[model samples]
Target: MLIVEDLLLLLLDDETGTPAKAGTLPYALGGAVLVELAMLGRIDVEGAGSVLSGPKVVAVGDGPLPDPLLQEAYDEVTRKPRTVQTLLLAIGGDLWKTVTDRLVERGELRRESKRVLGLFRTTQLPSAGTGHEARLRAAIRGALVDGTEPDTRTAAIIALLSGSGALPELRPQLAWSGEVYRRAKELEKGHWGASAVGTAVARTTAAIAAAGAAASAAVITTVTT
Candidate 1:
């Protein structure tokens, strides 16, 4: 029998705080994948859970393995990546829609596709270094494996993607500013008019305004051009 708690701990250790750990998204997604794998029979649930609970282990030689095992392993391998990607979409800050739409355009995901659809059929994982899409994918994956929180991990991933020109620069800034707002609220309870407090509020407001202006400009540009 699979020890649910042990599995959770192992996965959590690998994904905690990173994009994969963000909200309930990872658990929901990973659970679905686990179910598919279990049905396929590629993995013995108990054994698989044991392996995942510790250091990474090669599953022996194979082109893919049996459908059942393959399916289960596939989901397991991709859990962190998917979680990170969703986290990015969820808190993309100013560029939430833009980033996600672009990713869809590049075949990382299909905006109209259902989650139950097979990943191979519904989405094409981009080749590493192919473009901004690849970079974004890498960023999300990195964040998840590093055990960063979803929001914070997403922010860092956005920063990396933006730096690489995969994303527009303004979006990451906005996301970071939103974080500042949350932090500021906490600070306001104790520190009044402190430099950090003042800075946080100012940055948050500026980011919001910039996002709004950018959005408006985009609308105008789209209409005019």
Candidate 2:
């Protein structure tokens, strides 16, 4: 599964078929694609270690990616270098639908359609009994709860989950603790070992967190007003 797919699975509520933190889903999904492209050597950030100034994302590879989604992201980067925040929206604007369609095609999720008052249509994606998400959760749970160091892909998912502020939602399954929270926070800092990948991932995670915070504040302000 692609990193974005894995991240989406973790964020989505299995029964509700909605994101645990819907406000950050778009940004997190976008960040997932950026992380995947960086890992694949298809993209990089302008600054390798600078976190103070916003990092601008750049496309480095000219070859086509195996997946259409990755190729689309790479092409967007090739158009022009943009700050991590801007690029996230650019890539993630309609990503939820695209990624959901991909998962449905793979049979990892099944789509059910319904009508409200026989006038409006809605769709929900429930698990297809693939058991992939179960294994994924086990691996992540081991990393967060058991202090097991995760591989690069797993680390990326953790970073996205942390940035989205969705880790606490794992709750009983993960048995949230101080150590688990600290481990997740460390990964969110994006020390991914490779210089280019690390910087890009770090910037993307930072952007996601910032965006999520702003969204929360806006919701609060609206409710208060």
Candidate 3:
């Protein structure tokens, strides 16, 4: 499964089977795609310090990314020079639906379309595969609540969620909002705990991704408020 797919699974509400924060989902997914590309060496990020400033992302390959959503993002990056936040906003708006459709095709999510009061149409995705989401939530909880070492994928999700202000939505169930917030700070500081993730991943990249997510969240907050 794609990293964004896993991220989206956690962003989803178990009880309602919809995203907890609709505005933040796209930005989170956009960050996920960039992280995935970085992990694969398909893209390169350059900056002067641990935190990205005047950072530039360039594609490493000549062809399209295997996933169309990712391909579109790649195209956008190549089309111009943009900071991580700019790229996230430029490509983020559509990632939620793109990833959702990809999930529907994978049979992990079942699509539901209906008319609201028989007037306007709406679409929803109910969990078709429960086991995956269960594992995802458990891993996140383990990282935040139980102090278990999280893998790179899990760490990325937690960082993105926390940065985007979406992690608190789970406080009603997990009751670990304080821990979650604390762990997010650690992740932002380039601590991935005692895991392979720490050795394999760079702190600067995590900071950049988190910054992008936080910037996107700020934009959303501004628009709504």
Residues 146-197, candidate 2: write the lDDT tens digits: 8777777787788778866788885224688898888888777765444334
Q: Worst ten-residue run, lDDT, model 2? A: 45-54
Candidate 1 local accuracy as lDDT?
0.29
Q: Could you report the Cα RMSD, in angstroms, for every candidate shown? A: 20.1, 3.6, 3.1
User: Arrange candidates by lDDT, highest first: which order?
Assistant: 2, 3, 1
Superposed model 1: Cα runs more than 4 Å off: 1-22, 47-225
Model 1 over residues 113-132: C-alpha lDDT tens digits? 23444544342222222344
Give each model's whole-structure lDDT. Answer: 0.29, 0.74, 0.70
Candidates 1 and 3 compared: the better one by TM-score is 3
Best-first order by TM-score: 2, 3, 1
lDDT, candidate 3, residue 77?
Answer: 77
Clashing pairs in 3: none
Better of 1 and 2 by lDDT: 2
C-alpha lDDT of candidate 2 relative to the true structure: 0.74
Q: Name the runs in model 2 displaced over 4 angstroms.
A: 48-53, 115-121, 171-173, 192-225
At residue 207, candidate 1 shows an lDDT of 28
Off by over 4 Å in 3: 48-54, 61-66, 115-121, 197-200
TM-score of each: 0.19, 0.83, 0.82
